[model samples]
Target: MGGVVERTDLGRGDDPLIGRVLDGRYEVGQKIARGGMATVYQARDLRLDRTVAVKVMHSGLADDPEFVSRFEREARSAARLSHHNVVSVFDQGDDRGTLFLVMEYVPGLTLRDLIRKDAPMDPGKALELIEPVLAALAAAHGAGMIHRDVKPENVLLADDGRIKVADFGLARAVNAETQHTATGGVLIGTVSYLSPELVVDGKADARSDVYAVGVLLYEMLTGVKPHQADSPIQVAYKHVHEDVPAPSLREPALPAYVDALVARATARDRDLRPSDARVLLHQVRRVRQALDHGVVEDPELYADLMPGVRPIAEDTGEVTGELEREDRISILGADDVYDQDREVTTAMPPSGVATAVPPRPPQNLAHNQPPRVVPPPVVADEPRRFQQPKRSRRGLFLLIGVLVTALLVGISAWQLGRYTTTPSVISLSQSAAKAKITKAGLTFKLGKAEYSEKYTKGSVMDTDPAPGDKVSKGGTVTVILSLGPERHAVPTVRGKTLEEVQQLIADADLSLGEVTQAYSDLVDEGMVVTTDPKAGTLLKRDTAIDVVVSKGPKPIDITDWTGKSAKQAQKSLEKQGFKVTVDEQFDDTITKGKVISQTPNTGQGVKGDEITLVVSKGPELFAIPHVRGLRTNDARQKLEDAGFKVKVHHSSLFVGANYVVTVSPGEGTMVPKGTTVTINVV
Candidate 1:
């Protein structure tokens, strides 16, 4: 796949491996791009006679055996995928000390470059670009792999207008053991594309990739990330706690269904999102269909795409009943009592007013024991039933009395058993505390946790009811967990830049307490030398992280030392921390053993800088050559070739004779280069 070239300090020719062959198969060519993990170079597959791209890992990472193994494994896994939208991985091998991967070389720019040039793309175009990316992810996910780092830079746009995805399983491999941080402690994936679950718990699955794609779609349609903040931490927090605003909020021209699609895919709760890339791909197609149909308001489609609203559980009905009972008890005054006898009497008919009662004669005399009685008459065709009716009414009244007594008793029993004292769960682990609460027939709730030195992290520090406080059965018991000691480990920041050190301090929840400067030969200037407490020291949060920075190698100024003895000059330069190399030569003017010249005659250099000194070895000397029998031209040519400045001298009378009498410095002599030689011709 053609990846977007990330801007970096390195140029195309910066990599030393360029133009070198790896494994005697792939010949590395010009660098195509450089990223945090590796440098991509255009290469030639010599055996296959085809062009390929070779990605060479950085030395620092390749040195780690674990990381290298993981990298190789992931490369193999990615190679197994045969989707057309995926960049093909052909080979992986280590050459000498360098580890590299040979992949298909696509000829084009990256999605990142496209976004920079033409963004806020039309809805149709945005969907078109995202569809293929989803398909590639779908294939990877189907193989039980995840592209943890999904961003525009990994999405490639080929010259032929084909879209492809790169670096399929690399992020997962890197992030396997721990949260992978690139140089300067920035996360491996782009912060803008990080999912909420990844930010909060450092966990990711297929849904996390879906969330990233949703963010991608939003950026493509709106020209900006859905969540924006001053720092990555803040942006990550927003992703955890806030829902991504609809795209229409930024670009009102976007249809509502598009916003709904983004929302569903990026929902903070993984359960509410599409389960995997395939499901999200299906949703993408539906949205595309809506856009193609030119539907203005597709509420039905929007609803279908929206996350399912969770329904209240049936167990909540018990809670509602308890609440209602409590409300009724509070409303009813305890002092209020009813007069049962008066109530019964008020409900019954008056004896004197009732004409249906049986007729009777009262006794006249107090002393008389006998009394006269009379029976009631019935209506026509009906037997006398006055006494029976009265009996029936009396039976009904008794039944009502028993029912009222039973209702009062049941209410009293419920009130008596309604509440119980909460049990102590302090200093217990979260799971144990939850089990205890559940055993007590009460619900458990996790409340805000605070740092406590007395309790370990993830343990219950306190409860709402405080132990032994009255609480109803099935009542919620909110417990505050301890975050443990409020301490953070000092992170390794040596060799990092000042800004990077500051970021590391902040990420560790520590303050940039103080910055000191010092000269370091090993560390580059403006980079960190060491921290006060060093790395991996545990201390309270916000603890000052004093850093010592490098001022680079010490600078020294060179002084003029012409005519000085070579040995003395070498000693003087060496004492001043300069590396000196002396060269002996025959000088015409300077005395023997005296310094003739020095490279970088007058300049300032750092300690340990190399300085070359040229020492004199006296004037050149040679025996005169016997050229009496030789031709004059031959003698002159031989003299000139033997490290000499030749000067031919003709005798006054023998100007035309082609014979030489003698030559100066011509035989059996060692002379300095360019020494003067005189030849006499006769």
Candidate 2:
């Protein structure tokens, strides 16, 4: 077969075993998901007796020396960092040649999956979803780590519904190192979430991460993307050319504040946008809080405009409905029955009286009776004449009081609207629940069913609001549904010890239904040879299973080795996989070349064991040289050079053995080389 490609499997399948020792220490379990670089598996750590996710590179990639080294190094770096939000890297090693990274296995769906099922969240809720992401990013940023990919796929939603960001530094490692082209081409990260700067320059900084997060926020607030295109490249172009549309445009009921937030986040000019995730997060949170209160945020500017700059034009007076009509009336000449009394005499009523009243005749109207007989000194009642007219005092006061009461009522109604409760739909089937909510004049959101042992499948477990609460129209309500009993993926129990294999099955929430033994040379005793259902196959709870174990390889007997030649002894020991060592010595009575003593006696040694031996050569033999009288020093030297020990019993006698007076082993005398020789004095 051709070389296999290395990658993480996002889909379900069997985890392919590579190298030797299928379950030397860890019991391989079910396949979780696959990524561009490695395939992650849910496995049991036999040593620690805990479950973990193992990410193993494909044999093809692991075989590549460069990729393996880089993978190991990157794993080490990621392992050093520990944060609540970051997925923890626990261990990395090469079992034989299959390189793998073991990390804390988180059991949860990804944000991408969450978004796929439900999206375009309510403004308040969307902000809640992303706030934790911002917090995680902040922690990573503080540590000088950038999460190059901040898309929903990289965000995991735990069972508690809290988001935990994953794959922070993994992308850098994958991209920095080239991959086999015909193999798993391109890295695993989703391309849609990439920032423009990352796409163009292949560089991602805190700002770039911030940009990606902004994109995610945009998608969450708006049901769709800021701009969606047929291809990734087209989407990228739109990101650059198109400004983020206000969410209110899609859902007009959305507050303007939310729309502005999306606009600022997806600003085409990176410089014009928030410089970092911290700033973006703060703004997003503020909008989220203010959304409920109807706060329309104002855009930030460099400076408050300097005031008091005199304007060229005067302020046009505010023209109310009444004022506007008055102006129109003046321009069109009042359609009244009479003009301003200037030509009143021309038009007379049936009573022969002009409709227009004549203006006062240039005289102060101080006199009570129009200056009664003006000649009779006009005594003026100036106070009453100059007093403001009170022709309709009662009617005006009643109108003013009614206007004030209406204003108060309108304000109270608005306050009541703000406090209305979110609606609820409980104990209904999925279709029924949706219908009821829609009929009640609210949007319906369907979430993935969480497996529950207590509730039956397709039944609603609970709703966001308790049943029978008063919620404002258009308010969102979340419902939890049941998927009956939880299903587990039966782990591949092949090549594992019986004890270890049982633990794996249990960790997967499966039962050790039965165990069966079998004889096999390839598998060790008590080790699982194979299992039914194989691995990576899903099974419902309480499913029965069978496991086969190895009895062990046949045993080998010891061989005897004595009185053998050195070469024969070495060869015979090696054939049985025993390490051999040799040492030679001289013997006085034994003939030449025979084994003397052997460790363990060689009769009881097992295969693959070690043995030591002491070998003996022929009897000792030597030649001696004799030296007569000479200089005392020279005589001693000659006697000693003849392979003999010179002794002086009584050196006081003129010249003792010190002058080599006589030699016991004389020159040319035949003697055993191993024999000791001595010379005597006087």
Candidate 3:
């Protein structure tokens, strides 16, 4: 309805849309692969100039309104998931009834290819591969979404050493619309991987994904499928009725914990299995670590991972007829005992859906006789004419012991099933945390609010028993909500080193913003002088506070102010934060009040250092030697001898320049030593 719903035939013929562009962006190239309902093509994202995977739905599916609606929902769900181990969905489009989804193109083989070539792989290598798949599912589960279909076909091993899980919400779309494993009499999913719940009720959750992964793991450990039948429907029936067998049956070398891990994951009782993929992933990592360390016996790990109920029969494999007749007979009861519904037939159905069916008589068995696949055929009941009187005491005793042991095991398993671990819900919203806790069959109780810097306000901060701790299914889980970060006074950073203050800031739950340098007389170099907003200021945790660090005392440069005005020198030096000292002296050639000398006038000086200046005073005055009536040359000579420059001038009258008529500065006059004197000649 939102976009074009495909109506063309892409079902069973050469695709005509090959090499054609779709949505003006994704250039659909050649078909890479095709499945029952969709065809995959290697396409190029023209806008991004990168290769991507385009999956186009078949004709019947794309044309149906119900399927199209579900398809849109699936696209939104798949696009919401983002993880390193998940194939990212980029876009969803419909171009002229051709529905397609764009996804990250992984250039590598699928897990299916790996299993086809090198199945029954080493336990370590199998775990190494499956670990990433679980991580991807875990992310989806954490986001409140489920990957309904989990199988080897969806796991891609990229050439760049990345394992990505694909096709999220695809099964959900089909399942929601069809509500069965078969659509239009065609099988949609591989029946071998379906869980008991999925096979019976067509319902699934995170545990269903875990069950499929368990089956996947078993196939890796063994080279064949665990259950075999004449038809896919029979296999689905076996999924609901039988328990998945331990891998050790195929590979005896596998540790007990490995079997326990698989058993717990694939347990028919979903409650006994891990709550979700994340919980299962944790257990897988623990087991993998143990295997890596070569631990032969880890009772604790084995106990934790082992399924509450011990199943004596049922197995999965890649190929059919993996177990012989004798093996089958020893594992389960006769087929006739499974016949509960009289209307249903055990024979393979054409529709391929798993339905409870009456057990069919084996062709190889004698006429009118039940199957002997569960136990050894001790009595060949050939319709004997006469019956022999029967039983020995030993046989009776053996039967009694078997009944008692099975009863004890059943009771113990029921008790064990009641226990499940508390899942990690830290930093999740209060409603979300409660939903998950309750979904695990546990009760929820809100506890006191606590302050935490890591968690946000009203989000889950802590749990009473803590996550990963075992609790009864109906037991109450108390959650503490975060009250946000607590406020504290800024620490004392004055006179402390940068490193020390940084540590102090962290300890106080505060972060360092910017560090500035300043010259302080009291603080040493490379030490904190003060802090922005000063010290002892109350602030929230992780708040960035600016700091001021010291670069030692300020250095003052002496400008050598000699021969400059003493008043000007003192005033200019004081303005630069340096103390000024002045001394007075008399000089013959220098100005009377100008700076005559300075002390230590060169190089660098410390802050608050004193600068000295010497002021000039007038020179001593002596009698001018009264040169009136004396020869002009004699008067000039007398004035020049006294360090004073003398100038000669004649009177207005035409008298010979023999004597000085009047002498300027005639008598004693106080002046500087370099003062000039004028004389007149008659």
Candidate 4:
């Protein structure tokens, strides 16, 4: 959308119906162009909300019932065609005697405009423009609809560089009943581009369209029509009596093969031209490839493009015969004529030639004058000459007969040996392969089918004699088909043991690859956790499948702590993967900082095992306040008995006084039994 620009008009202001809307759906905006039978307008499809080109038939033609019926029929036929290079016909309707066709509106100049702007284009560019047009015509021809009119004006070159052919069946409708003018009568096709058959008899077919394209291509490459005249009748006469000259004559630098292409397509004898636009399309592609490869002369390709010798005077015409014979010499060498059945002929006379006429009136002077004397006929006598003996003549005839018979036999044998070969049907479906084989004069039989990695099921894989191998005409060829890829699905072996999984893999046409062990919560030990390329995975036959087995949950070891610090012991046990719990207890022998005992102190346990540790609280203590009033020795003995040490301090003035007058001011207190007690005496 960012790069696209919407076009609202076709830049024409002379049309009267520029702003008119028809059928209550199309909002006609501007006039694109006017043709012989219709005037195209840029219009919007209000119902579909899209831009389209509306081709409205001339009011006079629309008023005719026969023309309208044919128009509608041809419109439907064109609508049935679906191709990338064709302009799509969307809808057809009539509003108040105005017949119109809604078609895709391409936003670019027509090929006619391109030719006018860039005449004498290079051969490569000329082929590029014509290829898509041929493709469009090929689609129509394949669908049994002939594009009676194929010219540059009908070929649309879109802004995106896409070439599309427009007016698929319009030409047939316009030329259906052969409109005649008050002046000299002529056909509806463009004069300069009309085919010889069309101009002569007003009859057209796919080959006629091919002829038009050929003329168009010639004009593109030479900037002029192959035949030109002031009047349409005269131009039509040349088309019938003369052959289209090669493009190289006008553009002398053009390749000879290019000339051959033009000559083959525009041959005055329709039989000599491509049978249809599809065949012409193939020839065009081959010529384009040759040009791209810079091939200046390709006699082999030229012979193929224009097969067989040019038609003689008996086949086409003296004028055409002479030109074809000369063209073939330059196009394909004189010695390179490929022999083929000559089945086509141009027998019709030029149009407006007045084939039917009334008898002329008798002369009135013959009755008034006396009859003149008639002369008697006379005969001349001739002399006879003696001939050879009958026996000698018979002997000469017999020898000639034997020589002709031998020549026929030898030619037939060579043809059978050289032209017959097994056609390639590999990768084709069975029905398609059979059709090809039968068409090639060969019998086909279905042979054994085997699994293949490349071809689809039921498609031909190989042949008995192989494709391109020499075979006799009507020889039998056996075909082998594919059964599709050979693949096996991995079997489910989640709960199966290693040995059982291996056996299952083998049963599934697979090999046991790598076996790995891993701890799994769901699967038990020695059981498969899962198989690589898991269950139901399609793989090639005998593909290795990895397996993972389960090991039981891992075990952890507990550390002993009979004499280690309780806090340090709890940290050490937890680090070893055990849950630790501490309990306080009074122990007189064991140190207070040491762990007295532990639960599950030394054993193997899984992760998350609890280990309880009991720590020592030291000896019990009692109040020593009453010991301060007694002597130092007595207090010492009391404190020591209570698991405490006692000391006496003497004052300097009362050194001899060891009384308890001033004992180190002590009161009733509870402490660890190992605490020391001191007393003062004065």
Best by TM-score: 3
Model 3 C-alpha lDDT per residue in residues 548-568, reported as the tens digit of each score: 999999887778888988888
Question: Which 10 consecutive positions of candidate 1 have the poorest summed lDDT?
Answer: 341-350
RMSD, every candidate, angstroms: 27.3, 28.4, 16.8, 23.1
RMSD of 3: 16.8
**How does each model score on TM-score?**
0.44, 0.41, 0.48, 0.46
Per-model tally of clashing residue pairs: 0, 17, 16, 0
Candidate 2 residue runs with Cα over 4 Å from true position:
1-15, 18-23, 179-189, 292-682
Candidate 4: Cα lDDT at 10: 49
Model 3 TM-score?
0.48
Model 3 CA lDDT for position 622: 64
Select the stronger candidate by lDDT from 2 and 3: 3
Clashing residue pairs in candidate 1 (N, C-alpha, C atoms within 3 angstroms): none
Which consecutive 10 residues in model 2 have the weakest lDDT in total? 341-350
Cα displacement (angstroms), candidate 1, residue 660, comes to: 99
Which 10 consecutive residues of model 3 have the lowest summed lDDT? 325-334
lDDT values, one for every candidate: 0.72, 0.57, 0.72, 0.71
> Candidate 1 lDDT, tens digit per residue, 1-682?
1122362224455657977989888898887776556678888977556688888876876776546655755776776686889998777777876988888788888777777788889899999999999999999999999887788878888889989898876666556422332211112455567786665455679998999999999889988777776434345445654577778877898988888898898887799899999999999999898889888889999888876553322221111111111111110111133221111000011112222122222322211123333346665786756564334587788899999899989997887699776888977899999999999999999998876544678988667665666689889899889887667899999899999999998898776756889998899999999997889988755556788999998788897677988888899888888888889998889999999998866988888899999999888776545556688777767666665677878877676776877656555566666777777777
**Model 1, stretches more than 4 Å misplaced?**
1-10, 179-187, 308-682
